[model samples]
Target: MESSDLRNAGLKVTLPRIKILEMLENSDARHLSAEDIYRRLIEMNEDVGLATVYRVLTQFEAAGLVRRHNFEGGHAVFELERGPHHDHMVCLDSGKVIEFVSEEIEEIQQRIAAKHGYDVEEHSLVLYVRPKNRVAGKVGKG
Candidate 1:
């Protein structure tokens, strides 16, 4: 999404927004919550409030700069929606997120939508899976 889009949405380009965007840009983890983002901002010595973080996230989502995903839980996660679309695989044990793209899945989705005569605007696919073995990898951001 364009930075100008934020301006057009009547949101001032504040330091917190810029910093939050930077963190999201550099992060390998595709999804993060407002609390997750606020914690990171604190680690970076940014004096941004959690409420402000939530506001900025909502603004970004409105501007189509970020997408929100809920992986079978109460807390929602945010991810920068750039490039092509993809689905997620979340490890139930560790909450690790993996991004995977599949043309077959896309085709299937399109076919289903067409069969119902519905146009898909936006969609989310999250697979919550636990490791077959108890030996799961480290917990934290992916």
Candidate 2:
């Protein structure tokens, strides 16, 4: 988001906020933690601090500009909320996050919720996974 977008979100257009927003929008990796953003900012010679990163991220989340996922066994990661609905698959071994959408899964979820007499308002699905050929209980790279 640009400075105007930040203004539109009701957040003041400050340097840290602008830097963090630009970083989030331009990064190759869609998901990032506060530490991740801080490290990258350091690498880019930007003066944004970790605390500022966290604060900006929190503000962005509150303003509906980003989404945070607290995956199992990991610090929270943030991704920009500018996409169609999709589910996530978090790798148990590599900690990689993959996004996918399945109509069948959606339909089943809708059917189940309907049968229970409740309409699905919102939902988040995250499947923890390992490599398909990996044996059970495998720890890490061989």
Candidate 3:
């Protein structure tokens, strides 16, 4: 992928880099684990190794091309960094990850920081939740 985004990130455009970037951007699943990416590559008949996927994803994270989430599990999931910031809601039952943004939450964070006489530079909030009915436990995001 000969992308200006790649060049600006100070990364050389290679097949692996291009394919990985494309996969992240085009995939319907907003977040993906490295194994998910590797499996997709194999399904597409792309000759990308799992190790190479890890390496490329790490490089992208370093370059600010993607953001990694260490949600409850030790495994990390990655999403392309398209500029807006949002928090996550993880479904404890199904292990689903949902992305959401709330103006109220954002304001509350800033207010809390100011009350402490400290400016907010950055923060991450993850809400671990299960279905209200628990019986259904089908995680979903609106």
- Among the numbered candidates, top lDDT falls to 2
Error of 1 at 42 (Å): 0.9
CA lDDT, every prediction? 0.85, 0.92, 0.91
Candidate 2: tens digits of C-alpha lDDT, residues 1-142: 6799889999999999988988889999888999999999999999877888998999999999999999999999999998688999999989999999999999999999999999999999999999999898758977
Ranking by lDDT: 2, 3, 1
Best by TM-score: 2
Select the stronger candidate by lDDT from 1 and 3. 3
**What would the TM-scores of all predictions be?**
0.82, 0.92, 0.91
Poorly placed runs, candidate 3 (over 4 Å): 136-142
- Please give me the total number of clashing residue pairs in predicted model 1: 0
Instruction: After the best TM-score superposition of candidate 1, give how far the Cα of residue 4 lies from its true spot, in angstroms.
Output: 4.9
Q: What lDDT is obtained when candidate 2 is compared to the true structure?
A: 0.92
Residue 83's lDDT in candidate 3: 83
Model 1, residue 126: C-alpha shift (Å)? 1.4
